[model samples]
Target: MSLPPHPSSSRRSRLDAYQSLDSRSPTTTPTLSPPLQPFAKRVDSFTSSSSLLSLDSPYLGANRPLSFGEQKLTSSKFTLPHNHMLYLTPDFKEDDDELHMPEPKGQRLGIERDGDFASWRGFVNLGALTLVIVAWIALFAGYPIIYHFTSHRWTNLGAFNLGGTNGTGQVPIMPFHFAVIDPDTPPSAYSKPSWNDPSTSMELVFSDEFNVDGRTFYPGDDPYWEAVDLHYWETNNLEWYDPAAITTQAGNLVITLEAKETHGLDYQGGMMSTWNKFCFTGGYVEANVSLPGLNNVAGLWPAIWTMGNLGRAGYGASLEGMWPYSYDACDVGTVANQSVNGVPVAATINGDAGNGGVLSYLPGQKLSRCTCQNANDDPSKGLLVHPGPKHGDGTFVGRSAPEIDMFEAQVGGGDVPTGEVSQSAQWAPFNAGYIWQNTSTNEVIANPSISVQNTYIGGITQQATSVVTNTDQNCYEGVLGCYSIYGFEYVPGFDNAYITWVSNNQISWTLNGAGLAADAAVEISARPVSQEPMYIIMNLGMSHNFGPVDLPEIPFPVHLKVDYIRVYQRADQKNVGCNPEGFPTIDYINQYAEAYNNPNLTTWVGDYQQTFPGNSFLGQC
Candidate 1:
């Protein structure tokens, strides 16, 4: 700017300066100014002897070979390596256009898109929904199937045939009903005995004549008879009562006993009872029957007996104490306030309905209340006597429940006496000491113990009051064979003050021949008295109490036949002590449900159903 030098002089100075810079460093030359391009071109072609323009000049063309030091400078940090360099065409120029990378494409980008993810989400949701539906179906369908075989229908298929129909109607498993029998004899044809002069004439109150062939006596088939299909726990018998085993043929009610495994027992038998159907008080009851033959009589205990209406045949309850107590006067002035099984009996029909309460008078019946002060007043007077009305735990007990046995005949086996039949009256005066009583306060005692507080009378043992054995083969065979007539005559003290029992082998076709003569040959008792109402129970049982059954010797199927059963009451004293009202209805469904839920109560081990203390039968006395 201040007096600039000549161009040639300036250029020469610049070239000399560039040469000086190049000589300082042989590998690199300083960048030539843009205005000195002509000078650079000239220097590139120069081939001079001078060192500045020699062939070894640092200012070389692009095609010139680089020296070792030049090669080292090419790899400086300022420049990129050949492999990392952007690809370019041979004619590529550094222009203003933007670079274009390959269009971005990958799986990760596609997954982030909402449209594609929605489909994936739907599939996942469908899978989750399907799983939920499957779970719901499994819950609903599986429960009842699991519950059915394990709990429901267990007893119906195993323990007893609880559901079925006879020709009559639908039959319930409980409150069993029996057959009604109309006797061939008319009331007017019978003559009054000499002992019944003041009493009215005898009228037939209950009768059952087995005249119909192939008549079934199952539950609901007959109004007067019901069969029990259960194991008899009282005597620990080896027989299970089968309803199918009781039938009638050839003018007789037949109870068949079969030696086969039934339920848990080694045998099956037939048992019929008039429970809740026909009951009598002061009356004359008679039955003609034939016992099982002596061929395979081992462990056979066939019998005819009567129990109070307050007890069920094969169930456990506080009311079962009503049996074995034949005398009604045993409880006179005592306050019957005691509860049974913790159930208060202050208010119910006959004191307590199902808890073993006293049922003295029935509907449309007369009450014959009396007190005990004489020989009959003593509870310890007969065989199978009970102690006074005091529990073992110092608690007051209820009234006495009584039973009367027309005959409990023992078939010969082991220590049991054969050909011997026993007749007795039994009672339980104390509330404790029975399987049906409160176990916490009482010990089970079927027979009375000799104690200081009560009088022990003659023939007061644990068994029968009297036993009779027939040695006459004519009494068992011939036209009169197995046709013995057993009669129980009770004349309440109102008009006649005597009770009579007659056993005669005489069979009369007409009602006139069935007379109660006071002959000593057929008369058994004239002293015992019972005023309470009673029901009839007939069964063919095999007892371990007698002896184990000789299985091979058994005639497979044995029969006990009964021609007829008749009950007679004075015309003026009809329905006097009878229980016109049947037993209370039980909730068997709830009972079964309870058994199903409780593992301890279910009968799953050795047997098909729960029997005794593990299971309880509902009853109302």
Candidate 2:
């Protein structure tokens, strides 16, 4: 006897095919009518014949046979063979095992036999599975094409806001690359200069054009600058650097030096520097500066210079070390005699090691002296020089002293007064001096490249001396009309050593881009060139002890108007070093203790007591 095949075999195969197809697509299973009730009732009785049905039916393939209880035959509208039709009868063969269903010959076995409803179910399930797979493939292949057309249609119709003024009257925010600028607008007028040569290309890293309106002073609540409101005692300068004297007006920075009583000092001045805010190794730095009254002022020392940033704190501890070794100072006036026009003038570039050697004054040690030409003239004397140790070769040996006086000039006659009666007989002079020491032998050496008309050395036993006078006729008279560009280019030697065969450090100047007379600039192929970073500084000082037998009275309320200060660096110089450490901040009570040597120097927190209330006073020194 034969029983019906299992219903699960056909259903499981169709379900497996559906899963193997893409799961993202929609799928459906075919619905079948309920199985014949007679077949369901006879399923238990035909368990022994289930294996035979599995082998005979083509739909079952080689699958294992199902038990009689597992087979469920559904109704079908098809003809049946006589032998197979007996299995469909409700009362067919429970006890008599002789009755059997015959397999159909030369035909799809289950389709020709009426009671083989499992084969019909399998055919319906396979067809449904094929339709689902085809639908899934169509959807997966057509999605990209549909998306492209839909997006294009919306974009062309302006349905999406791509960036234009919105209903709120503001432009929609977009990426920076898409923004546009008007071509008619001009670039910034005070922007950094652009160079055509690639080797000299400069990128402006820091600057201040002083263009801010209503700004009375710099770094005014701005973190990029720190105002220096303290006094400097290293040079024994007469003026106290007060922040109140610093102001900004007419789009320029003005530092006023007035002879007013402040902090027990006879003169009050202003000084400002970028100690920690910014510093660079080597650059072309320049400023358009106008000096104060130059007529008959013997001690007015106004300078624009720079100092090394090493070992300096941003606050009170900035000057931790001395200055000569680390500074590049440009003193605008160094006068020896009264000017022909009553206004004396000169320019001096001084570089040295700060406090490296001892400074002592000897009594009655007259090196050299010169007298005036007439009876009313005051006597002139050479500067009292320092002494050095005597050497075995009869030449005195000096300590390793390095100094660079890149340029020095005077508008009047030399130290020796000329006997000429006319005031026009006074001569304008220029000078450059340097004293370089051999690091190995400590012997003083004079630079051969610089030329001087008259040289002076050996003041007192001649330990070491250097002096150079101007051979050129043109001398700057240190006046307001002398608005010229002055700068220095310090290129390091090979391997950044102290000395090299090719000398590159030079001091230069130009009047409105036109070169001055011959021998105006100085180049020293000498040792002791500074190899450290330097920061910029500007100040007005008095009584530096440089010239004249009698100190000339200085005019009060002297104003040093600076148009701008700019720094530029070459594109290829790689060793642009900087110091990031800042010194600890000292409280007001203990400020300037080292400089004054008196622990009782007064200190105030705010810009003096006059600007703010009594609450601003930190403490008295």
Candidate 3:
């Protein structure tokens, strides 16, 4: 149905006014009509349809002419601010068009607005990420540099493993901080005589410098040492001789004594001998040694001495007759005792086998088997038994051996037995003595029924006595300091038989160029002046009822360091030679002797007196 459009009240007013103005005067202008309502809403009211707004409509309201201001507003292109009102020209045309609403002004799709605060936040995050990456790169680059300079380089020196069923574990390959030599410390202050110097007349014989380069598990493998595996020998010691306790380090032979258990014993230590390897008839032997220095702990009996190798092969069969001779430098008093018809008897023989029945036996005569003992039982008395036999025909029986004492120092609280006596504030007191069987007493040997002449005699007072005077200072001065040089010189004569000396700082001798004093020297006019080949033996033994019974507890793993053992013989005596089968090779001896030779060997003479305070006979220099 088609109907004519009705005018609104506002439109009626404008029409009436216009008619009145025309009636009043034909030339008068009428007032402008008020603004029209929105055409979109008016169109919506006219028809209830979604297509009322056409696709190309400009105003969608009335068609009116534009005023000057409306023409200016329509001529300019402007965009509407968000949520602000929209303006249209007064002369508007209707057209169908799509209205595009401006997008919301704030954030979209989680992206922030491009403002000062947002920009600053983004800049800070980027800077933080950059810093993290730079730090990682620096760490990677600098790590190798730091490690190259500061990291520790591990080595197998002075290190050993602690675990294994047989206690023979692989040596650890790690750096031992404590074992490293400090670069700032000075070297050893003392120097020993070189046997090969032209000015020196001695020739090197047998030596074990213990200069092995790599780690050694057993010292016996060195070809020059025979590790003693004996459990007990005369002395009732508490320690068992263990091969595990021996090691070579720092160019020294190290023997450690520990308070641990092994072989069902509470203590363990080491004993090494050159029994069948290298033996000498007469020569000068010395060893540079350092003892364990611990407080309150006693029962340390360390010795470096020699034993007769009579019955051994290569040695002259005639020498086997003198197999009983031994040179001992021991810590405790050495005595020999025998039980006569079930009666306990004792005597102080020092190192000599007294005029007893043991020596009375003729060649091929079997000696009566008697109970013999050493200083292990009582200082005043111990058992002495007959040494089985010397020859296969049972000739030369009994304990006719002579023992020479080189050096022995006993400390802690105990009875002072025989030998040279000295006291120290911080160390074990020292008492050294020498004894040997004097076969020169022709009157006793010539007597018939020599066994009856072997009657028990009380203590035969030693012809010579030794004293430790204030003139000689203590070798070990501090509570934990013990280092000494021990040696002996044997001359094959009754006048000045042998002289042994022990000094803490260096090897020293008396002022007369003799190694020992006239009284301290071991001299036997008749026989038993060390006429047979002997071997070297060094051991660390415990108490044999020898030292103080109330000894303090000893700590574990105490060390004894032997820097080197040097053997020398006079050039004239070197021609005497040695048994090729059992002694050191001649080539080996000559090589070492030649290597150690120096033209500056004469410089040692003056310096030797400063420490030894005596005429120097170490060399012909």
Candidate 4:
């Protein structure tokens, strides 16, 4: 077989072509190369020549050293297929055999070079798509963490599922010793019928042990608690709420109600609040309290409750909630059933009977004052409607009633029995009916038996003497007195499910912190109007329902003492906290408290009107 064309010969042929273009050659008729053989035969001939040329070929390096390109082509490691010709002549015609180049050895671009190059692009596209999808999922799942560091507001979406002292994602604090259900434990351990802690969750968020003795609550004396100076008119209590009446002693908060007249009221009492300071949506809340007097303490009323942050305590109905009701909804019923103007008021706003209508004009109806529309004297014009003011994340912080009465221990008034306390929640339902009055005749029509003022849509009383008793005298006042842990756990976002209140009314109690059986006292559902962020309020007042004060039985200078107050909120719920839009920041709240504490700065630092600008206090116009 002939050897492949030498490098010198190929270069010499190219030179000869150039010489022929300049010099004359005999113009002889070209002989057609003996009737050209088939193209495959030519390829076979070329392959034979290439196969003969090897690394030890005498033709190689016989003349001179090979150039870099020529050496690479002649290397023993590089070989071309004997049947496939990668190189084609200028006039090459189509042939039966396909042309192929040498495949790469080993890995190329991180993939096996098995000659399937086209598939690499498909694999790369699929890999890129997978990475993008995973990136999006991580971003969405970690949003709360990112928001915490970047944003200035607080959110209830809670931090990441971090390890905490009390189960998962909960801060360690003094756990309520009376809890009957351990959320962290399995349900099968309990013998009685069980439900989740109220709404299946609990995490400690706020706590105040009143650890500092002789601590006086005067405006800014305490960071979390403050005293209110006002005559509370919502319940028409005879006593004026005085800030000077609140103090702490022996690790307990004390509120004294005395006969000394103040602020035009014949009597004076004490009120403490956590307004505009800290608030939460829903969770377990509890406090250890000692009542001022026995259950039959004629007019004395002591309460531990919560109210939405959109209302200030001292302000009248304009800035304060209507107590126990959220945003208003008016329902339509027959005149005989609703008793309004001798005619059925049309349900024009919210649609039909079940859904409440907007607070608009209602002829001779007294409902405008009954609902949140009481903020405006003439709500018929529809000037201000909730969800009223836009705040954090542009969500409306409503100026509506969202109250949860944990316990109001009283007697000789309302439906409460002597020695028993009441636990309840309240809200304005869409089906709430209204009373109407005649324009000229001045006659009112309604069911005399059903008064909305004293009615409790959702309520329950403490267990009877068999379950709880105060005979141990383990409390203040020394005479048949006792201390009891009273509290309730609230869960929002349920449809028509009444709230559950938890109480361990034992005067001298045990931890019995396990599962509890389902019973009437704890299972009574109340109106669910407490969906917003509510602050804490503890006060002592005189109730009109109990008639005149029994001065002899519960005389002047009565005391309502509290051992501690703590709050546990749902870890997975949404909440608004310090520095949220339209709300004061923790630093600002502290700054105000500092100024209030300064005796030289006589002017009140928390003048709601001046301190909070650009909108009305609690969004009340």
Candidate 5:
């Protein structure tokens, strides 16, 4: 800015200054300056030293020869060592163009982009897999409700069946029907004895009083049963329950099947009653009776049966005290042949339904009919299938032609029911009883206890009073059997027998039989004057010692059918009498074995011998 100086002088001074500056710089010579190049020229820059250095970071000129300018600066002219000169050179250039390294050209860039894309795809695929797994779980775990909402209102895919009561028709309940009641002779001309009557107590007992408007007894009607003392709680109390099927008549009061019999032995278990708890009474009574229908097989034992209530006696004649056993002719004790000597009454009716003998009796048989023609269905007998043959007429009959036979009887009809097998040992599943059916005869009988409460007079509750109403009307057979309890073996007659009760104080009985004397009267009175108020009693017995002593045969699956029994008496009245001696206990039994089985699993231990070691032989009683 002062004045224009001479170029030569200024240049010389600048040159000297440049020389001095170069000495201060550690690697570069100040005399050199950057050179300009065309854009196309830069394309071949790989030939440059900078390019070589960038290609490999280790290209730090460590082994490269030193630059001429650096050599000159380090050593005089050319005397410097090569390594020393190279070491003095700078590691790299700081040019703007050099600082920015260009990526490889062409295919290399494409390859790098492809690698990035592959990695992104892997991440995306993993995310999709996680989403799919979550979706699958949500769908599978909630299928129950989803299926129900889309299908049936009430699902049965997962259901339980119990007693045909699941509201679903998946369970099977055997269909056995009963109709008509009559009392006549041997319903099966194939059997013994002529006329018969219902073997059970008169339905009149269910009413406030007997029929015939409380009919007076015949002159020789001295049926007397003494009162006895039956200890309860102190001993094993026999539980008597009211039937769950039938209800008491309107006029009926609450007949106590209750465990409250007031009398000692006379009326033991609460107010017990065979009528209130009996399931069936086997065998025939001595009377020709007729039911509402005709042509019906006339079978009689007594209308006291319990598919359920096997032991329930009314206070008036509580069987509770006599529970565990009784000297009833059917159960144990010896007695008059005509005496009603059985336990509650056990019987079965099989052979008659074309299931007679052992052949047709086998399960899965095609078709079999009753031994009687009209036993299955009859217009005259109105399906004479229940009660008994019309009122004790030896004309009642059960007929059927069998395709086969359970035993070798019906094949020839040569009196087969009484073969040696008839007397052979028979046994129930649960060690209940053993029954032997007369394959040839129509007798389904057993050796029952001889005496119940030891009758003081000849007249007692036996064939004379009532006959089994459900077995063939002419109850040539004398018992009914059924045993289907939880955890207990399902015996032969248990499922097939038609046993039920419907009453607070009464037990009515009905079986598969078509003949029973409807309304046939059979009365059970302790005496003209009983304790008045007593408990009910009931049991299932397979034997009754009362019968023609000559006929000692028994039957198989013999059964007693019952519907419902009723008990009626003055509401406020109570049995007032000292009970008799202790009621029969199992200890009272004196037999080698019961003829048939009691499905109810009570009293009988099947083999009287079994009791011998534990109870009988020891005389535990």
Candidate 6:
């Protein structure tokens, strides 16, 4: 009774809004049946297997032409697979009554024809609408594969989580060795420790329990000794001392660095040292190296310096005097300060220098000296002998006794009578109390019990009634440098200048030379006045900035290995038991050997405390 429109004509309705082919035009046109059109020999080829037809053929003779009726016949192979062509099938059965409706009256040409045409058009219209809805759904719900390949990241966030692959964990965390440069010491004398290999280990012990920090110096920087380089020598080289060259090998330490060269260096390098970060402050620190290099020059040097808990903070202080000129008037003829946070500080009793103050380093009682002087007799000299001609710290010699030198002058000697003079070198010793009277000019500053010329090892001095005066200015108001903040110089040589601390103060301290206990010695004094914990640092530095030397070559992969650095914190269960900042005693110092995967617990690094060039958040000034 009806035939479908041609494929092209069927899709025309979807392309334009023109007055469509009149719906009322002609339904009686006998709906072009197969009798008016040609058909293919393979009729089932037009219909997919899922439809009512299927095609499976072995041959179709070249000249064969299927008859009209045979060409219209469809296959009944119902077992074939499904496909899009299945939609073309007449969905009704031969016996289906509704599909067998009488021919529509559309040929009548008016309202009736229009009604008939509309009924047939309804099926096509419904199909078009359904197809549109399906296409829209697929577009919105699917994630396009093309998008994934273009953007490197899954999202537009543009960031990634790298995890812990960064390289910070790979560096060795502990400082393994230390080398000191004092005014009196010779530069070429650099050698290896008596224990461990020079390139792999160090035999220096600096524990909070054994608080024996030493001092070092650079040219024109030892505001304390004020050493005058008569030869104007320069010290810019250092090396790793091997085991065959060490002096002592404590079970806790490996090798030592004893002066090996005979030609002395007179630069005012600082008497730098450190403590803790490894051992408790109540611990002990001992180095078996001596100053065969420091025959007579003044100026101090430090081997170690620790605090109650200095390893954790940026700035801190605890009773320790490794660099005496750093605070006391040890280099009285020179001008330098020993201070903290830009304030004058002292920690020794050398003569009239500490007259009004106790052995404890206090604020106001700084050993005051006269105005700075350029010449040897200006009476005032600057502490800390740095490299520049105008630099301070080197107006004197290291290891030598101090005197006014009002008569016979030396390079750093003074040329004035604060009051009078007593060339007698008869300064008395400190027992409890003592006195003296300078009948000439009568200028008395202090009358400390212990006093004697050449006898007072490394501190300031003043007879019975003489105007109190400070000599070294290393720790003095350091113009605009590191000491500028802490007015006093942190000299390494002073009274019992340096005291050692162990897990408790009972730890013993001894010095040795060539691997045996010798002349180098130290006794523990009272604790520092600060409340901060301590840290450890070993460096062969020149005053402030550090630079590579041009003369000597630094072998790649060379190391300053530390055999061990034992620490002892007097277990008080109260106060000094743990660190003030890095408390609870974080692993008694990492003592690892290899440079990777830190396994031991007695290691630390000096790079963590660098300042000046830039401030190190860990243990900085």
**Number of the top-ranking candidate, with TM-score as the measure:** 4
lDDT, candidate 6, equals 0.23
lDDT of 1 by residue, 272-345 (tens): 77654456766777888776756224556777888655445664332332334333221221112222333322
Q: Give the alpha carbon lDDT tens digit for every residue of 59-94 in model 4.
A: 453335567666555453443333233345644556
lDDT of 3 by residue, 1-621 (tens): 996566687799888854565465434333344444455444545564345544423643224456767655554434223322122553443353223324343443455555455577898999999999988877897787786765544321111111111011111122322111212122331223432233645556545556653434343243334454445433567888776777778777787777878778888888776533455666667777666534334556666666543222112221222223222211111122211222211222232355432311111101111112221234453221122323334322222123343444344342632112121110000112232222233111211221111121212222121212111212332243444566665654344454433344332331111222222222211232444445666776677544652245555566767777766777666522223232222222222222112212221223111111111111111
Candidate 3 Cα errors over 4 Å, as ranges: 1-200, 213-220, 295-297, 311-402, 412-482, 493-496, 505-525, 549-551, 575-621
Task: Give the TM-score comparing model 1 with the true structure, all chains together.
Answer: 0.45
| Candidate number with the higher lDDT (3 or 6) | 3
lDDT of 5 by residue, 134-220 (tens): 888778866765765543232111111111211121221211211111121123321222112223222211211111121111111
Better of 1 and 6 by TM-score: 1
- The lDDT-based order of candidates, best leading, equals 4, 1, 3, 2, 6, 5
Residue 589, candidate 1: C-alpha displacement in angstroms: 17
How accurate locally, in lDDT, is each candidate?
0.46, 0.35, 0.39, 0.46, 0.22, 0.23
Query: In model 5, which runs have C-alpha deviations exceeding 4 angstroms?
Result: 1-24, 27-141, 144-437, 440-621
Q: What is the Å distance of residue 299 in model 1 from its true position?
A: 3.1
How many Å off is the CA of 361 in candidate 1? Answer: 29
Q: Which ten residues in a row have the lowest lDDT in candidate 4?
A: 458-467
TM-score of each: 0.45, 0.38, 0.40, 0.46, 0.18, 0.23
Write one digit per residue (lDDT tens) for candidate 2, span 275-342.
33345555455555455555333455555555444323222222221222211111111111111122
Positional deviation of residue 430's Cα in model 2 after best superposition, in angstroms: 25
Comparing 1 with 4 on lDDT, the higher-scoring candidate is 4
The lDDT, on a scale of 0 to 1, for candidate 1 is 0.46
RMSD of every candidate to native, in Å, equals 26.5, 26.4, 24.1, 22.8, 28.2, 24.4
Model 1 residue 14 lDDT score: 89
RMSD (Cα, Å) of model 2: 26.4
lDDT of 1 at 459: 17
